[model samples]
Target: MLIAFFTNNYKPFVGGVPIAIENTARMLRRRGHRVLIFAPDYDGDVQDEPDVFRVLSIKNFNNTPFSLPLPLTLRPAYDLDTLSQVDVVHVHHPFLLGMSGLQLARAYNLPVVFTYHTQYEKYIHYLPFPQQMTAELAIRLSTRFANSCDAVIAPSSDIRKTLIERGVQVPVHVLPTGVDLQKFRGGQKDFLRKKFNLSAETQIVLTVSRLAKEKNISFLIRAFVRLCTYNSQAVFVLVGRGDAEDDLKALARDLGIANRVYFAGELVGKELVSAYKGADVFVFASTTETQGLVVLESMACGVPPVVVDAPGVRDFVHPGVNGFMVPEDGEADFAERVLTLLDDEALRKALGAEALKTARRWSLRQTTSKLERIYKSLSAKGQPRGKRERFIMLRELISYQFEKLLEEVDKLF
Candidate 1:
């Protein structure tokens, strides 16, 4: 089957969404299916992936890592013969290039499958409009887009429930981006000894996330400070960079644990694997994730995480079996859980072994096969969406594009 993916994020841009797209595309290709990606050009250089069609884009929009694609540039690609034969359209976002893909799917009369990848309402700080207004609009617009599709892929059961509450009438499947288990499980590395001049006896606690406010990173740091009060050898390491880095660093200094905290900004490839494997415990406080890919990665490396009890994280963790889940309101309890693992060698090793076993259940091969089945089932259907439904979807998408154009013009003046 020929499957096409339209996303606002892709390669050369390292983030959760791009990583998910890359993993899904690679796994599908390995399964004897053809996949094409329509994405924004990040570097304006020669294309690395032959199957990807680059749409003209504004790199690093509003000083953020995301690229703003010029949707008009995508029309010429639609004229290509190869694209015309695509069996299904998998859209990874609800706006921008997502709308362009919907237009393409409609013209070709193909099945459209939309994935709910992020909690857009949580990122309203990136928008120029008023917070409440933009957030409400985001929720409403995303729900309308989901309803416009033939089927929706929710990364977690929590997201599916939210969609139903918002009146999404289409078929909703709870499917998440799976972890590449081998990437971390292949080997072990003592990153703490190599990066810092720390001994093997030192207790290492690690967390990987963009140092953004929405991630609740400050909460993690405060919890880490509490752990430091009791364990002198325990050190906290953060493995990502974002706009809030300076503020977070200041917070650490104010709390007097500056020396105990290490900021390992933006690790990728082997460095990331080493960080996950070397740590005694993995900690996460983000409440906005659609799924906990990083937490799963940590588990694959045999690290047990004590994560904040939230919708996405709960799907992967079994309280006594693999990891601990602290309630969102229990910050002190969160620290206590991590301290429990850090101080006890036997219990930590027991949970760490179980974590690797748990991670295997959500491996890439398993998840991609499920995606293939869904595509085949959807493609077997006899007809496209109703004519009236297609017309309404197109009209709404065009109006959205026009409004975005006006905003770009308004910014120029």
Candidate 2:
């Protein structure tokens, strides 16, 4: 099967979504499926991945990191002949490229599926519009786009539930963008110790995430500081670089724990593996994640996580088995849980073993095979969404009428 993925960004952009798209595409290709990624060009540096078609885009349109694709320019630049050969269109974002892919899918008479990758409502603060208004608009747009698709893919059951709640009237599949278990499991690296100047006796508590406000990273830092109050030997290693780096560094310095805190900026490949493997336990506080891929990655490296309980994080964290999940309200408890794992070597080892076992279940091979099954099922159905087509058309008509009515009402007022 030839699957074309339309996303806002791709390689060199360090994030979970890109990682998912890249890894999933690679694994699917390995499983005898051709995958092509349609993404905005991040600069002149082209990715080494084969068959990635980059669109012309304007950089730094908003205060956000994502580059906005110039759809008019993109249309001309796209290889429509090659795109027409695609069996399935999978869109990872809800705007720009998403609309373009839907248009392509219609023109080619191909099935288009959408993945609800991010919590758009949470990121509405980036826009200049009113927060509530922007969030509602984003939801409406997401719902309409998702409903138009032949099928919807959710990274976790939690995201699927959100999509359903937001009025996505289509088949939703709860398929996580799985981890590359082998990468984390077998790699050996002495970089973490040498780079950070840490001794064998130092206990490393690692957390890998973008240093963004939405990540609740400040909360993690506070908890880590408290954990240090109990376990002086434990060192906190916060990996990944983002906007909040300076603020987080100041917070650590203010707490007089700067020496104990190591901010390893944006580790990839072997460095990332070393960070996961060198850690005694993984600590995360992000409340906004469709699926915490980093948690699974850490677990695969035989490092159990002590994460604040959120819908996505709960899916992987088992209280006593693989990792401990602290309730969203329990910040102090989160710290204690980290200290517990740091203090008890035997319990940490036990949990790490269980974590590795759990991580094995979410291998990329298994997830890609499941995705292939979804693709085959949709393809075998011929018209793909025959039953839902009429319903979608009717819904669009009603929506059009409602918008017209609202516009006329506004004119009167």
Candidate 3:
């Protein structure tokens, strides 16, 4: 089967979404499927994956900060002659690339599948509009985009539930972003700690995420400061960088934990793997994630997570099993949970062991195969029949009405 893997960003523009797409595409190709990636040109050398095709040279918009590509001209390769050759169009994001893929699929009369990767509504705080308005717009846009696809794949049950609540009539499948087991499991703990200047006695509480407002790094800083009251030897290492770096640094200073917090900004490869292995506890406070890929990476490294009991994290971190889930924004509870894991070596070991086991369940091969099955199922059903097509058309009309209503509301306020 020929598969077109569409995404907003790919390679060198590192993130969970891109990584997941790369892994799935590679695995699918290995399974003897012809795969092609449609993505924005990041001005990097293309990888030499025989079965994978790269379509480049598209113009990018909002190039600063986020580096999102705003496609100026979109023509399906060979006037969608090649697109017609593909059996299914699997889009990883709901924005530009996904929209392009959806349009091409419609033109070519091909089966379309979409993966809901991010929680767009949670990130509305970063937008220019008011939070309520931004969230409503996000919901309407996401619902419309998702309803277009024959099947929607969500990384967690929480995301699926959110889509259903938003009136998505399409079938939603719960799939997780898988991790590389070999890269993260065991070994080199002491060497990693020594390399990072961290002592064996130091309790390393780590977080790896793009430094963005929606990541809620402020909450992590506040909670870490509170945790310092119980454990002075605690060290906070933050990986990744973004607009919030300065604000976070200032917050750490104000909390009087500047000396304890280390900003290890934007690490990859061995450095990233080592950081995960060296940590005593892996912590995440982001509420905007559809799936927390870092949580799985940390778990694969046998580092237990102290994450919020939200959508994506809950799917991986089971309280008293692999890791503890504190209530969202519950700074006191977050601090206490970290302290509990840090102080108790026995509990940490038990949780870490179980976390490794749990991480095994979400392998790249397993996830890709499941996605393949869904794609095949959709392909077998072919295009929507008379009543089904009408139903979809009606849903699209309702979605447009909702979008107009949101626009009017925005204009009013």
Candidate 4:
């Protein structure tokens, strides 16, 4: 099958959404599908590849926090030209690029699939508008964007539920964003520790993510400070870059734990794998993830996680099994859980072993196979039966018409 994978960002730009697109494209290609990625071109020259296609020249929107690409124009000509050759179009976000993909899919009469990766509602606080009004507008836009697809994929049940609540009428599948198991599996812990300048006696707790506002890195800093109050030998390592770099540094100093914390910005490949393997525990406080890919990677490296019990994250970490899940804002509770893992070597080993086992369920191969099944299902359904027919059918599905009709006899109550 010819599949057009669309995204607002691509390689050299690191984030969960781009990683998902890359992994999906690679896996689908390996399975004998021709996958072409359609994305906006950044200032730097993107390598030309047989399957990768760049359609627009975009500019960097913000210099701080992170670099976001804003397209020079909203014209659909580029997308229509590239998407005309594909059997299916899979869009990876609800941004300008995704809208273009939706338009092209409509024009070509192709099946469209969408993966809802980010919670734009939570991100509204970062914008200049009133938070509630902005969130509402985002919800309306997201609903329309998702409804344009033949089916919508949600990385976690939490996200699926949110979409349904916002009146999305499409079929939603809970597919996890995956990890590279071989690269992250068991390895030389001592070598990694030494490479990071840590002695065997030091306890390492790590967090790998972009330092954005939604990540709530300040909470991690506070929790680390509390951890250090008891265990002075514990070290905190942060991997990844963002606008909050200096703010996080200043927070560490204010908390009086600057000496014990280290920020290793955006380590990838073997270095990133080593960082995961060497850590005794993984800590993440972010409430903005659609699915925290780093959590699974850490688990694959045999490192247990201490995460907040929030959307996207709840799908990965199971309390008392592989990791601990604390309340979203509970810094003390989070620190206490970390301390428990730090204090008990036997418990850590047991949990880490189980975590490795759990990580196997979310392999990239499995995710790709599930996606293939969805593609075949949509294809078998055939071209949509006109706009009105499609809209009525979608409304019936959303209204639970069959179930409602069956229960109508008992509605007097």
Candidate 5:
């Protein structure tokens, strides 16, 4: 099968959506399928990648790392002839390239699949208006986009439930991005300790996230300060970098935990795996996750996470079995749970064992097979856009574009 993906961001940009797209495409190719990607061009992005297409874009928007794609027209980024042969059209965001994906599908009479990757409302701080206003606008636009698609892929059942509640008429599939078990397993346990030159007795509490506001890194830092009172050996090690790095570092320093916190920047491949393995416990407090891929990665490396209860996170966790899921609030409770795992090695190892088993169910090999089935199912029922369907889509596209313009204006005030 041939699949075409229209995504707003891609590799060298650093985010969950890009990782999901790249890994899924890799598995598809290995399974004897071809894939094409259309994404915004970023300034330091590696050139000449296979089966990838780039359109004009502002590499940074308002001093932020987000690239604003300027596709200019519905058919700007894709080739008419190549697009006609694609079996499926998959889109990762609900705007920009995502809108373009829907347009191409409508024009060519192809089945389009939309993935609900992020909780749109949580990250609307990047917009100019009050969060509530921008959030409402985000919901309306995303719901319309999902309704127009042949199918919507929700990374968790909770997200699917939310989509249904929001009046999404199309079928919603629960398909979380799976982990590569082989790549994550059996990482060198002493890797981080040796790299940072820490004593073996020192405990590492790790989190791999893009240090951003929506990630709730500030909350975690506060909780870590409280945790320090209980365990003198514990040190917080954060992986990944973002616009919020300076603020987070400042927070740690002000809280008098700067010496106890380590910013490891970003690590990938074997080093990333080792970082996961080196940690005694994985900690996270993000309430705005679609599916916490890093949680699964931590579990895959035999490090049980003490994460707060959130949408995508609630699906995989079995408290007292794989790992502990703290309440939505309360730093005291969150700290106590981490201390529980830290103080007891046997209990931590026992939970970590079950975590490895849980990780197996969502392996890349299994998820890829599920993806193939989804594609085939859609293809079986596929039909070209009839006159009526074309009319409806064309009208919806115009409305969507106008709404987008209104949003830009609203940002100013």
Candidate 6:
């Protein structure tokens, strides 16, 4: 089987979507399937890789301070020809590249699948208009995009429910991104501790995510300040960098927890695994994740998370079993739960054990099998019905035009 993945962002750009595309494509290739990635070129930093296609792209709208990659189009002559040869199309995002993926599927008479990766409404602040206006626009556009796809992959059942609630007519599949358990099983924490100059008796609390507003890092810092009052020996280490780094650092200093907080800026490979293993507890307050891959990574390393009760991470936390899931508004509760895990050694070990057991169910090997089955199922369905396909193509065209109008209006406002 030949699979073509369409993503707005790729390698060298830090985010969950790129990682998902890379991991799935890698595993699919190992499973004897030909895989290709169609992504936007960012600052000439991306290198030529086997089966990967990078198109010349530019960043227009200064939407966010993160310098996000916003591609112009995917209709280049060569790209069209390359896309025409694919057996299946899997799109990671549902706005720009997503519209292109749907159009390509129509042109090639192939099945197009979309993975609903982010909660669009939660990110409307990037636009200039009032969030309410942009949020309504986001939901309408998202629903139309999902409806046009042959199938929509929701990383969690909660997201699937949201799609159904928003009137998505297509089939929604619950398939979260997978974690490589083997990578975490053997990673030693001592090396990381020594490198960071942490004392053997000090406790570590970690949150691995892009330092962005939607990630709710500010809320976590405030909660960490409260947590420090209970346990001064604990260190809060934030992994990954983004536009919010300076503000987060300043906030930590203002809160007088700067000495207790460590910004360990994006550790990959064994170092990342070691950071997870060395931590006594993983802490997260992001309520906007489609699927919290870092939560599974933390659990895979036997460091259970005390996360806010959000859709994706909610699927992983089973309270007293694996980890605790605090409610969205429960900042105090979130801090208390982290303190609870920190104060009790036996309880932390028990929860961590359960977390590892739960992590096995989401191993990359098992999730890849599920993805393969989805691919085969789409292949088996063959091209979409002729009349229905034409209607879908027409609807998508109109929807794309309408979305562009909305975007223009947003810019004007």
Report the lDDT tens digits of candidate 4 across residue range 236-310.
Answer: 999999878899999899878888999889888878887888889999998888898889989988889999988
Off by over 4 Å in 2: 384-413
lDDT of 3 by residue, 28-69 (tens): 877999888777655546565543434444333333344455
TM-score of each: 0.92, 0.92, 0.88, 0.88, 0.92, 0.90
**Global lDDT of model 4:** 0.80
lDDT of 6 at 103: 70
Clashes of 6: 0
Would you list the clashing residue pairs of candidate 3?
Answer: 61-70, 240-266
Please provide, for model 1 over 272-336, each residue's C-alpha lDDT reduced to its tens digit, 9 standing for 90 to 100.
Answer: 89888889999998899999789999998889999998888888888877889998878899999
lDDT (CA) per prediction: 0.85, 0.82, 0.80, 0.80, 0.86, 0.82
User: Lowest lDDT 10-mer window, candidate 4?
Assistant: 385-394
Best by lDDT: 5
Predicted structure 5: lDDT: 0.86
lDDT of 6 by residue, 35-149 (tens): 8777777664458898777766654335443234334544552456766667788988776666676777777778878899988899887777677756876787778778777
lDDT of 1: 0.85
Question: RMSD to the native, candidate 2?
Answer: 3.4
The model with the greater TM-score, 3 or 5, is: 5
lDDT of 3: 0.80
Q: Candidate 1: where are CA atoms >4 Å away? A: 43-47, 77-79, 384-413
What is the TM-score (0 to 1) of candidate 3? 0.88
Looking at candidate 5, the ten consecutive residues that score lowest on lDDT are 384-393
